[model samples]
Target chain A: MTDISRDVDQQKYNQALEKFVSSVNGNTAFDGDFQGNIKPYQINQRMLALNVLRNNFPTVEKILGESVFTSLAQVYGKYYPSTWWDVNIFGDQFAEFLASQINSAKADAYNWALIAEIAQLEYAFIDRYYYPGHDSTPEVLIEFSHFDYEAQQLIKENHPNLVITYNCLDRFQSTANGEKFHSSHWSVDSSQKSKLKIFSASVFRQNFQVVSAFSCSTANL
Target chain B: MSSIDSFAGKQCSLGVEYMGAGLGLRFPHIYEILSQKPKINWLEIHICNFINGGLNQQLLYELSEHYPLSFHGVSLNLGGPEPIDVAYLQRLKQLTNELQPKLVSEHACFTSFDGRSYHDLLPVPYTQKSVEHFCRRIEQVQETIGRPILIENLSRYVQYSENEFSEAEFLSQLCQRTGCGLLLDLTNAYVNDKNLGISIDAFIDALPHQFIKEIHLAGFSTHDEWLIDTHSAEIPQEIWNLLELYLDRYHNVSVLIERDNNIPSFQELYNECCHAQSILDKYPS
Candidate 1:
């Protein structure tokens, strides 16, 4: 083939590929057999991001057992495979997908928030472990003061890689052992002056360890 | 949390085998892994909520007392334009200190950009700015974790115009500059090969094998001829061939199987592990 023809063919092929991708991704409507004449082996080459199944069937894990959950996931996977690369975020319309399924209402009856909260909790837990902290310098120290005192206290307490803004001051307490930091309350002491403090919060050795003391004085106390 | 044994030239915990291959330990299989005890060399603890909301640390400590762990995580969102989540980092550090994992891993993809989290590992244009930004984030992560991490290659659907470097070269440079290891996801590489018209061999050849500390193998389904790394299903034959190729070329490599959904029975997964082990045995390390 001539160079001009090859270029035209390549351009056409790219256009077809793009259209097929758009159709599968649900970006564009696909009325025809989108898989085309691709070989069965070739069909397996197409990518299906799990985000679609995750978002679509968040509670499938609870209503149905994991085995059934996965079988259902496969059905959805065939019908609405994700075209995006980020598998974790692909299942945006999963709830809608559930509603379309057999007895999906019953499944939806299950506390999705609980499932989501669990997933979020799980994600956050793993995230806290792999998360990295910033430099503990004096300049950087000032920025931490903007955080609420109760939060500061909590940081001083359980140095778990979690961000819980104190809902009340009852939540904060300095542990005697210096190793154990626990907080049941999230509220801050509004009366105590918001003083700057250099709290050394470390996610060291699989523990949320902290060493904190006030950096600035409170005139009230 | 609990005392673990330091094996010859390496470390070992009670139930956790350091045979090298790993899989992201998920909730569905928790009982199975603990009860049936599928023999995994390493268990990649997903770092989503291990250190949050006052979950009993003693349970995990007990698990660690019994098993050796390596952490695998999402939500780092390093490419997110917002300032690094310091609270997140602090919690991560605490967990790492507890686990003392063989290695911790995260995606090379950015989760958020410009402060708005897409909550996905979105692709970045392989530009000089991106390279520098990514390196800086990795440096910060290493500093926070007090150790380096292996950043996995992402399976992307789109390309950013800002990209100037090939994925391999970018990873090679990132490892060289930051002293970070590469979590080479063969399935992701295969996906990129189909999507981006890259030669898989050349892409592998570009990276120095020494920088590749870990390998990821998983099943992928297709959409419009694009191979998506979904971490569901069994490992595809093509990917197995690719794995064999990778093993043949790189020895002493730590490998893993990632099954996010369609989780089979522990027995079934053990069969898959055996398959992988046989391949590894052929090429040792």
Candidate 2:
């Protein structure tokens, strides 16, 4: 730790930093005309959050372009406006947001489902970027063994055009101690330029099996 | 002794050290910076971004090996009428211990209120009681981090009607009381000058030269009649002139160029640093 220096009155430095501030707020012993409006701060925050979200989900922004993306970003902010300073929690629901846009015929340039898929992929990569990698991945077709019945049901019921829950992410998400990342659906074989195998329920079953394999790595994209 | 009780004689302020002109290390510019290894004086980061361990943190450690680094934070909320989070400061302290940045800083303004983070620096009302308010928080931060911090004045939309002292006087008292230093952000001064009619030159003159440990030079955007310190565009000539005014007396203060929005290409930003570097080279220790 850097060297700390404190030489203020004890009567003033009342509580711990947070507790002290609260007491100060209550005491009202200090009188000043510091009337702060929260609106300007809110406006700036919306802009900052959008810029950061654009960085976090580049593919979504690039596909939607500036005008479309800004519109989507405003809508995204309205729904999930919690500060994205922590990158992990910022875009957790972005894919869902994109998918909802399609339902409303808002983004009709291309396949919105495909765009949602891209968002999911990008978010997973970002999550992977934060968690980092400790395991080495081979550049071959690898089997993922962590899928439960619901995951298999989603793939099997959706048929050939199903939203494949990129299983590689489930096996590799190593959450940090006490970090609050709730979603565990994105992983990358981060060691080398490795092939990311996306397994669908139609392709895999009770046993580890693959009927059709697709290279869905962000590298290929 | 109660944790709230001041750490008896545990305070130690770091001495003045300058590393020419520097740039805020943004995530988008990191990969290119790693590969290209551009010529730059130093790097300042938001501190919160790298506190959580990840590839960015790992890369930051690698970058620290090659450049002089400083930690600039936004969450301290030193001027807010709320409790400062102890856990946040401890995490910050952990990173400070691991990286050992030469200079560590937070704005003199509050960032978060109640539980919601405003996510932008709000102005602190300059009054005698608020001076004590600012001092106690700065002392708490200094006490927690075990280092004297440089308090940067913020850019805001409004000035208080009950401002007892000018920004310079308020900051001077805080420095005298708590042993803290000032990070004179010239662009913020320029904004407050234009928007609030406070004379920038007068503010600079009133501040003790010994207390100004660092200089922050950046660009601001115009909002109707007000000048917003948006750090988005290239460094304006007016802000550069302010740096000249500040550099006239204060030397060996580290200069940093900040860009938090509409960040341009690395070459463009790095070239802007050359401009500040040119000015720094004009003045010598």
Candidate 3:
């Protein structure tokens, strides 16, 4: 084929594919839409996206309930369309989407913050589960004591890849306290601040299992 | 030489294999497979699952040590209009070089078009134009990977009006043009037959028999009058019958039982493999 014919063919394919993508994304006005099953196909596409979201963010799904979760997932599907071939990576930006949604909602500020933290935690787990480190050495076996005190401190300061931490301790503790108070009383005052306890936890994959270690603020170095 | 040797020699001559029967390596059954060292002939794995370097990659390396592996991928959208994703192909090539799988395969359908990807196997119109475009992409992929890849048939819910060729005719012409092999998915064919009123026999008969290098057997579910290829449940009896009919003609093909969701115990999947083996055992290669 001549270069001119090749360009024409390429143009035709691009046009057809654009129509198909639009139709699949629920723009049913495209000429390439499935003859009689466009509506059903659209529904199936949404369900596929929702299923991926639920799988990736089980905690968020449970907290938001199915109805609300499905509504949010549909909106997310439309706003943040899948750009990768692997659906596993399709929900990479979902935590940010949840944060935006929570900010827009007219819910209790404390409860919504807790929900957003849960989304962050769940998305982190999903990302860690799939993209764990390439090193063959076990993370738990790494000895910080082997190096001198100054070297160890430098390593701890510079080596960001050594740990996966979610700095949501305050939110986690507050949510627990709020749930405890809500079990006995109908409502808890959002203005009342609980005792602040700062801590950190490192979640890592060891022996094909997710393991974590927590250190409280009072622990001696 | 033993019968197995003869079969292997013949298959190797064709640049493929007759890896008698196998099962998809699911994470749930990874421990059992690694520890027990089951008597299965080979294993098929979704290549995308192990693309990222992690515990999964380590496990895959170990599994390759025990059993011959075949890499099946879901992300290579060969039928799409855009130039195939070069980055994906590079990663795939890296994995292929590491595993040195007995066979590598992807679907004949497209999963992405333009900049957006559906993440599901979407059907391509079976027109002459589509066939040419799809074959050109397949040729490009083969050139990039430095090896021929098998293309599997998809179980589709809709067909385009502009389609000028049957699925089999398109596949046969594709193989003729690009020298690619076929991964005849019996469950997909059965589902498409029931859902679209296409004749399964005609579909199978349309393909060039020698190009069929692999076979996939899986289960489907019925949802709102549509037979969905969920690969969740056990291989139904009708699909088994279809397998028997397929084996009658093609004896030198690797068969794999795939279960992705609602996975059963390892014993149950092993029994399914044994059942497929019994059918393959019925006909001498």
- The top-ranked prediction according to TM-score is 3
List model 1 lDDT by residue over A1-221, tens digit each: 57796556444433543454444335676545232222322233233334334443333454455665666566666666543323444445554554455455455545543343333322333322322242322211111222334333433244332343221122133333353433211122345456332222223322322112233223312
Model 3, residue B116: displacement in angstroms?
Answer: 1.4
When sorted by TM-score, best at the front, the candidate numbers are: 3, 2, 1
Give the worst 10-residue stretch by lDDT in candidate 3 chain A.
A140-149
lDDT of 2 by residue, A63-123 (tens): 6788888988877776675543354447678888888876676656666775676666555
List each candidate's DockQ score.
0.03, 0.16, 0.26
DockQ value for model 2: 0.16
Tell me which residue pairs clash in candidate 2.
A3-B146, A3-B147, A4-B12, A4-B146, A4-B147, A18-B83, A18-B84
Q: Per-residue lDDT tens digits of candidate 3, residues A46-139?
A: 7877988888777667667788889889888888888877677567777677767655754543255555555554554455445635454333
Candidates in order, TM-scores: namely: 0.57, 0.70, 0.81
For candidate 3, write residues B1-285 as lDDT tens digits.
764454344334448868888999998888678878989899999988887655567678888989999999998888887778888788778878887899989998888776877777878778677888888888787888778899999988777765779999999878877778899999999988888888899999898788799999999888778888889899999999998888877787889999988999999999999999999999989
Collision count of model 1: 55
TM-score of A-chain in each prediction? 0.35, 0.45, 0.60
lDDT, residue A202, model 1: 24
**lDDT, candidate 2, B1-285, per-residue tens:** 542232222223447687888988986787677677888888998887776554446667778878878999887778776667777788788778878898998888776655545566766557666787888888898888888988887776655665678888888777777778889988888887787777888988898677777888778777556677788888888888878877777687878888877888988888878888889889877
- Range of the 10 consecutive residues with the lowest summed lDDT in candidate 3 chain B: B4-13
Model 1 C-alpha lDDT per residue in residues B1-285, reported as the tens digit of each score: 221111211121112222565556665566556655556766666665355422234335545655677777777876544557787688779889867877787887665433333344555556555566678888898899888788888776655433569778777667766777778889888887886767789989997666677788888877667666667788889999998888777787777877877877766666777787778888754
